[model samples]
Target: MSDVFERYERQYCELSSNLSRKCTAAAALNGEQKKQMISIVKTGIDEAESLIRKMDLEARSLQPNVKAVLLAKLREYKSDLNNVKTEVKRLSSGGNYLSARDDLLESGMADTLTASNDQKARLMMSTERLNHTGDRIKESRKTMLETEELGVSILQDLHQQRQSLLHAHNTLHGVDDNIGRSKRILTSMSRRMNRNKWIIGFIIAILIIAIALILYFKLK
Candidate 1:
């Protein structure tokens, strides 16, 4: 269950990154170039929706309202994307108008020139903001991946240590068994030595008795 959650979280993060990258690229592009990124952005958004639903199912306590809000926001983003696409198409089809407007703006005598410059500045600022946001998200993702890798390394090391301790425990048990066997052998040997000493003493006593008997007989 934890593994499933982890996988879902990873997928959500990856989709978020893909969406951010696509948005950043879209911000800097216009016309066909920007249009080309829309499908990729939509794919990321769809994947994110699926991931969130999976997460919500896993966490029963999760509020459905929150998911609804997220889906609503994604819909808004999609709407905005369509509007931008339409605007790009319109601008691309009006190339002659754009060139004429640029010439007039260069002449520096039209009131529309200032508004155009302002709009361009705003677009540039928006692009920069998107790029900055994408960079931060990318950095955060990289850090997360690194932390996960470190955690895995630590777990592997701990497992190896545990195995080593188990092996050492088994070895100690074997050594203890050998020591017990040696002790039993030593005890048996000690008992045999004691019996041999008693038998030798009895034989010596018998020899002395025999010598005494011989002396008495000779005297008789």
Candidate 2:
């Protein structure tokens, strides 16, 4: 049972580390960055699910109290990953880029895009929440380091660990929201910049046409 617990604990730590990486990536990722994040998330989810299945089997063979705590923690991790999956799907849908370059040009999208920087500020706040959660998880792990027993005390320790996991779960959700908002703002800004480029090009073309007309009339 101790061996199985050790194995499960290692796997759980790996999953948590992967989740933190994903959250960090999501906070700063652009469209291409998002693709990279998606890959990381997918790999992490697959590994976590596999570990969870093994944990379930091992749990069935172990003592009830130990098995119960481990199973509960595993379920929480699974739920957090599933939430991340949903967020990834929403991000990949590209619904946020509804306003094209032409639309931006016609609608003064630069101003609109500039105004959305507030969302960036909000995202920064969300990153703070993630950082706080990471700190909490580290603190919680420190308590486990001092533990010398594996009886009922282990159950209480696991409960504290679960609370730390919940913090991580909440942090990930905050990251997902921030990422979605940031993606929309970025896509809008890109479209606005493209529109400005087109406008400048058109102005240059008009100037060239005016020069040509002037030369023709003067020579005639």
Model 1 ranges off by over 4 Å: 1-119
lDDT of 2: 0.67
Query: Which segments of model 2 are wrong by more than 4 Å?
Result: 94-220
- Any idea what lDDT model 1 has? 0.63
- Residue 151's lDDT within candidate 1 is 60
Candidate 2 TM-score over all chains jointly: 0.39
- Per-residue lDDT, model 1, residue 152, is 53
Note the residue pairs that clash in candidate 2. none
**Candidate 1 at 143: error in angstroms?**
1.6
lDDT of 2 by residue, 97-201 (tens): 322222334433346666356445544554566568758966885665354224335666676688799999999999999999999999999999999999999
- Distance from true location, Cα of 160 in model 2, Å: 32
